[model samples]
Target: MCSGIRTNLHFPTCWDGKNLDSPDHQSHIAYPTAGPATFDTDGGACPSTHPVKIPQLMFEVVWDTTQFNDKNLWPEDGSQPFVFSMGDTTGYGQHGDYVFGWQGTALQTAMDNACFGATCKGLTTQTTATANKCSVPKTVNENEDGWITKLPGTEA
Candidate 1:
């Protein structure tokens, strides 16, 4: 149960108020401050004129990997599975960043239920009462598909 699988989420901080995205797709906006500290309740602003400030989002979820390493669960790519990914090159940074967003009210409730969801049985035992509150994310990592990208000749 000590196996470590961590998800580090980084979001954007500043917007120029005009561009839907930047030239590099990353630079048009900026981080008011470096890293996750931008999310701090006590943190400052991104120069009043920027118009839209998407207070950075920072969070990490670490799941135990006792099962991820199991030999019986090899992934479909015929490659070592990926537990998480950032700025996947194939997508060219499309999946890498976020700017201004908040975890909506339903998100917390949904996460709680997903993490601690009880086994659903016949109608005798189901999550009907709280179904609305507990969202089933469009994508869930039901499989141990952990991918680690490294330059050639580099050990993962």
Candidate 2:
């Protein structure tokens, strides 16, 4: 044998703005009467509904070959040293420096590796020329395939 009880649930009727005299007139409003109340009783502007303007960042790169070479001149250390400089300016300031050390087969190999995917290569040579008289050449290939070009004549 089994026993069951029946219960009744009632949902109040909704009221539109025109039906102010209706029993469920409060339901005409969009919000529920028992739900959390909004700070804007009269429906003030929503804090998150306003449009916000974002700032745009501007940047430019200025290169002074003279300044770059002057700062990156590596002093003689018995072996020839190769020098290279790169700059990237995007909202950030200019950045330049030298990557140099040693010479011969090792130096060549290092330069080859450094300029693997680069558009230009650092100077490579066997002679340990003085900083003032040194001719730093740029390479088009990492494997020393094409002719290596010297930087435009500039005061060391």
Candidate 3:
């Protein structure tokens, strides 16, 4: 009920599903249409040729205004990027170095209790990293800034 600022993210409509990531990265997937915009997720297949229909991945990132304001975070200059990205070749095409580190409680509780939507309510903070099959170094990205100094809850 206390969600503040927010943003919406929509993944590519078509997916190859074979590569977790690609080198050139552009050739492995495709979008069959072009327009000002029309995201057709009407339970349709990818294409007649390569049939892989992925359930649309929609991400709505809800942020707390108290901590996420432009001044507290980063202000808009004429050319300063409000955000920095390491991956995604097709996006801003900003291929460069990025800092990777944990910012909050232990990596264990984050791995075990991470959820998408309504399930994330009434959560507790943990203070240690528990390394197991569920808690690997590479799995940390799934945590998605879990170290931030705020709890995760968005208006549904």
Candidate 4:
């Protein structure tokens, strides 16, 4: 059986105090750096350049690869047998980026209230079924489902 894998991502929690966005999209935000141990472990202050403190966003994802543990599925060379959606086979190139989608001052209000979990003041919580009903316009027009011949752009 596959041992499975889990990945955790922490977003930048400091803002530039001016523009909401940067040209390349990530320059406006930075991670904390105060404690001596490490930048991420400290929960320290924002750098001088990015002084405005923002909510720290974190995501954790778990994958079940047990179905692929069969020896018949392994390549003769013994290389990895899985690939990420973006065509990353080695998995080291995995990265995440997203634009803030909170409505108006809703996010600000939550931050102001020091909200944790679903009990924050002035914040509304929804069940997973309700939240899953929401959808955004597709940025890329491509078929990303089913057992396709190959990943979207990885065809040789």
Candidate 5:
């Protein structure tokens, strides 16, 4: 059986320098450009519309399918047996949202110093155990685990 699947996500880094967000939640930001010379690389510049360039946010996720490695566990027709929590079976529909949570200029200061991970001068760092102790009041009152009829916040 195959090991697993890994996906890389690169969030838009160019901001409109006006609105922090839009009705569709995407109009105010865009990916950087290299002007057709070559695919946008590390040195790519933001477009005129979104003149303010921000630090890029990237994520890497690894899905574990080892428990279902047995051929008998798969569908008889040989279709993929995985479906994302958002009901995306095609995989292409996978997406994520972001909300700025850094306190004050914490993020901006760190970015300016080229800090990677938790090495910024003024930024604070905590162990995984300490961070795990943090929690917030549940705003969405719903069953978030086990089998469910549909994903939360997705109404027809």
Candidate 6:
């Protein structure tokens, strides 16, 4: 029952292969056995414009916030706020495709807590300025704790 705002993430496909001088070379080179399969092919010689799949060593997550709030959360200046906790579980080669599939989960906390909070117990901090303005706990002693500590004998 987690709900706040939702968005889509896109990933660019890439290949891991050796730079070959010509396309005629098709000998199966011994690729790195540790990770995904790799081969030697002419650079940028793939016939199709679409991306080709290769050994997926890493992946990233990206998001667009344009229509997030209007979809689910309250409508504001298109600035929807929410906390996202994501991690990959499915190991490589789970899917038959050369690209590996990943399973992830995201939890939606309070809007204010997720959007403008300084410190969260189990969530990552997003904004330091918002945290400072909110007077959340400070990591350093020099930080003011929402109090004006003045000298007793100072001139009024």
Best by TM-score: 5
lDDT accuracy of residue 101 in candidate 6: 33
lDDT of every model, 2 decimals: 0.50, 0.32, 0.42, 0.73, 0.73, 0.33
Question: Considering summed lDDT, which 10 consecutive residues are worst modelled in model 2?
Answer: 49-58
How far residue 114's Cα lies from its native spot in candidate 5, in Å, is 1.8
**Model 1: runs farther than 4 Å from truth?**
1-3, 38-43, 47-51, 55-63, 68-156
lDDT of 4 by residue, 1-156 (tens): 466766667778888999888898889888877522232464688889988877667765667777667866676798766777777776666567766799989988998899866678998988767966887999999875433446666645
Identify the runs in model 4 with alpha carbons over 4 angstroms from their true place. Answer: 3-5, 34-42, 59-64, 77-79, 85-87, 127-156
Clashing pairs in 1: 12-98, 54-100, 81-145, 81-146, 81-147, 82-145, 82-146, 82-147, 83-146
List TM-scores for all candidates, in order: 0.38, 0.13, 0.31, 0.64, 0.65, 0.17
Better of 3 and 5 by lDDT: 5
**lDDT ranking from best candidate downward:** 5, 4, 1, 3, 6, 2
lDDT of 6 by residue, 1-156 (tens): 233233322222232344422253322222222323223322333323223433222232234444443444533564424433222222222222123233232233423244223444445555745644654566777742222223335555
> What's the C-alpha lDDT at position 24 in model 5?
91
If both were scored by lDDT, which would come out higher, candidate 1 or candidate 6? 1
* Count of clashing residue pairs in every prediction: 9, 0, 0, 0, 0, 0
Deviation of model 4 at 95, angstroms: 3.5
Candidate 4: lDDT of 69? 77
lDDT of 1 by residue, 1-156 (tens): 237655555555677788877668866666554333333341446655454665345554556666667655655655545433452433233334444343555445443444223542221235656653665665765653453345345567
Q: Which ten residues in a row have the lowest lDDT in candidate 1?
A: 115-124
What lDDT is reached at residue 93 by model 5? 69
lDDT (Cα, tens digit) per residue for candidate 5, span 1-156: 757776666788788999978999999988778531222464388899988877767665677678778887777998767777767877776566777788999888888888655676878878767976887999999865443445657885
| Residue pairs in clash, model 3 | none
Cα miss at 33, model 3 (Å)? 1.8
Measured with C-alpha atoms, the lDDT of residue 104 in candidate 4 is 86
Clashes of 6: 0
